[model samples]
Target: MNATPLVLAVLHPRVALFELGIAAELFGLARPELGVPWYRFETLVAGEAAAQAVGSLRLTSDGDMDAIDRADLIVIPGWSTDAAPPPAELCDALQRADARGARFMSICSGAFLLGHAGLLNGRRATTHWRHCERFAALFPQVRLDPDVLYVDEGRILTAAGSAAGIDAGLHLIAQDYGSAIANRVAQRMLVTPHRDGGQRQFIPAAYPQRRSQRFDAVLAWAEAHIAEPLSVATLARRATMSERSFLRRFQDATGLTPMSWLSQLRIGRARAMLESGDAQLEAIATACGYGSPESLRAAFRREVGLSPAAYRQRFRMRNAPGAAAITPP
Candidate 1:
């Protein structure tokens, strides 16, 4: 990879605004504060510089499909999930780029184009969960893991859905500049520093949207007292429900059990603490509601695929202004 990789976002007709915006935000925007060589970004379109997009929006590209020849990283913001083949010129450009070992990433339905170009053959990939069945049927050669937020198969990457694109982009940043820079970028964007790619994508809500709001106070309370011992009984009492009823309702609302939700919440808090500070393992373990440093290590490794110490060392933001310190409750 070059010190300054050229990132080309390939836009198609009826492209998704959110995914395209994510690409521009992650790569196109300048960040002098990072004090490192950043990506050189450009938009690529086939034929005319202007193309139609979702919401009747018109997008103009900085270059034509030929720009693929120069891009180190090519981003397919999105494509329609239908059987209609992409432009022959676009596929040819992508195939040529792939033959030369240029990296490729697809967001949401954009995997369809990569599959059409024979880029994902015999490689593990993912698309939006809703389109998994269709994607599988369309490209039987590609090994589809529909549950992950994103799949980073070295050169070819695919994000599960709309928001998963953010995770995928941050993963790329981490790969290029280390976790500290990636976490800082995420902080500037006001998003979580990291969500493991192995995390599940399908989180079903069994209750009406309004009813799920009942747990808002409980969630806030739990986050506020994350270092304290918390139990289903105590949570149920706070919500004024029986233990069994609370268990069922919580699962219905959150797609996770009360303890599971709390565990993840604690892990998120721990990750923030690890990224922003140089606190000792014992101190962090205590603040994150762990019984011991060993327990913290076990859980962090299980959830984040890194030990707390390793995570801290890799992601601790140094000398970045506006990086807030996370206070443990």
Candidate 2:
């Protein structure tokens, strides 16, 4: 990796100021005390000279598309609109950068711009959870992992909602420097050093949509037996109802079909085991009712957008927080 990577942030009209601030603070500021060469960051206006942003604030980029063209990494701090296509000039510049092996990153809705530039096609990416519907609908080809805090696909990286931008930035720093440097940076920023990107963006919470009557017993029973074959017929039988009635009530009660609910529960359980323990895939697969490791991988990919091993590698709990911290010999 280049020692002093040049980072350019593309700022557009009505751009998100908070997200832009994250990149600027993390990369634009000089940190000679870091004991390593840090990023050389600049802001390039995407479409206009002055951007009218939230809270009636206005911002102007110090540079232009030419700066972006010369950058080693470009950051887009979320887009203002889901419907409007990105400016032609910006798209061309991004394509040029990609061709030259320059990395691109986006915070929150900025993924929309990458989608418009045809950069996220077939790539796993994410934006804020609130706007996932619009994002997924617009770019179906982009495998939008709506649950993750961010996605790092080698050259192209993306972050989730507002604060997740910080996580994404620290992750890049860790990759370039080492975790000790990242931890020091985080200390200065007053934030956690590493919140694994694989963690769910939103926790499963009780909602008003669930059925009024408590199905605690059924849920508990299912949790204990999650490793077993969980067919709708079997679940319905346990609930003492016919399959048709069970399907209807389950949908009304949980807002998910029996099979879908089971799949989610199974994945959640498997994820817990993966994150907390070093159990082998075969054991986890059988315990999680996957029956085979191949089946487990497919399900893990579909639900989590990561294979079991990959998820464990990225998110598994450790004995020490500074495990990745670099040491000088």
Q: Pick the candidate with the highest TM-score.
A: 2
1-329 per-residue lDDT for model 1 (tens digits)? 89899999888766688899999999999999999999999987655668787567798766976789999999998887888788888899999999999999899998999999999999999998779999999999999987788999999889988888999999989999999999999999999977643433133211222247889998888878889889999999999999999999999998889988888877877877777777888888899799998999988787666677767776666765888654433
TM-score, predicted candidate 1 vs. hidden true structure: 0.62
| Collision pairs in model 2 | 78-110
TM-score of each prediction = 0.62, 0.67
Q: Write the per-residue lDDT of candidate 2 for residues 168-256, one digit (tens) a residue.
A: 99998888898999888899999998664353514432122335365556777777898898888888888898899988988887888
In order, candidate lDDTs are 0.84, 0.82
Candidate 1 residue spans exceeding 4 A from truth: 196-201, 205-329
Q: Candidate 1: global Cα-lDDT?
A: 0.84
